[model samples]
Target: MYTALLHQYQLVMSSREAVFNYLDTLKPEDLLKPVASFNNESIGSLMIHSADTYTSWLVNFARQESRPFYTADNYKDLASIRATFEQINLIVNDFLNHFKDVLDAPLTLPKKEGMELTLSPMQLFTHVITHEFHHKGQIMNMSRQLGYTPVDTDVIRF
Candidate 1:
């Protein structure tokens, strides 16, 4: 299951690279342009939010690590954003390795005082990936609103 999941994740990453490649062609200011309908979220901010979600779930919550979340200011351009994703890739790899055998084992996560959430590693992984795709759509829509046609970033490219 872990091996299959890893392969699927690889495909997702490949599609993600396509999105990043398109973003590479964008100007830093374009990436930072706030969309009024998106609650003032720029493409760069959405990207950083996705990365922060992965780190928050896999590294901080799952592994009990104190990985700090990244702000939008930390990734002003595509180069910097990609660099942060490189770190996210490493963190994801470490997480998969650590939980390879126990992907389904229930984990008790704390949420506020006197509150707890029971989830599994696979659940967390699914959540983060889906969350990324959700924001990826938003980014593409934002780019279109900013006068750029969006390239298809789906996993199954036609």
Candidate 2:
């Protein structure tokens, strides 16, 4: 019943893996350096934020658990960012492994200032994948601005 969504998840994660591999080749300063085009957000910060969004929507909100959030400081280099994402990938796997039965069930997603949005687990899952790619484009742009080449993270490449 969920084959298409599962395939999409695999493709997105693989693309993210390619992005991470490219990040590993960058200089430490470049990863943390703020890009004017990114509203002064460092490349590492963008990646960290995307991963945090996934965890927030999938684990914390979905499971009603308390998880610590990270900031730009947490990802000063590619290695640090990759380590954090590795952990996030595990959490994602667990989410997918157990969510088959409840994918269409309603979920209340918290928002800033005590607001919330109600949606199905499937919707939240799709949002996370798209959200990651959205920020990932910023990361790639920042990388190029910093004079670094980025790996192609297109789903077609996977």
Clash-forming residue pairs, model 2: none
Give the Å shift of residue 10 in candidate 2.
2.3
Model 2 agreement with the true structure over 121-142: per-residue lDDT tens digits: 7887888988999998888989
Off by over 4 Å in 2: 2-4, 109-116
TM-score of each: 0.96, 0.86
Candidate lDDT values, in order:
0.90, 0.82
lDDT of 2: 0.82
- Candidate 1 accuracy as lDDT: 0.90
After superposing candidate 1, which stretches have Cα over 4 Å from the reference? none
Separately for all candidates shown, the number of backbone clashes (residues 3 or more apart, or on different chains) is: 0, 0
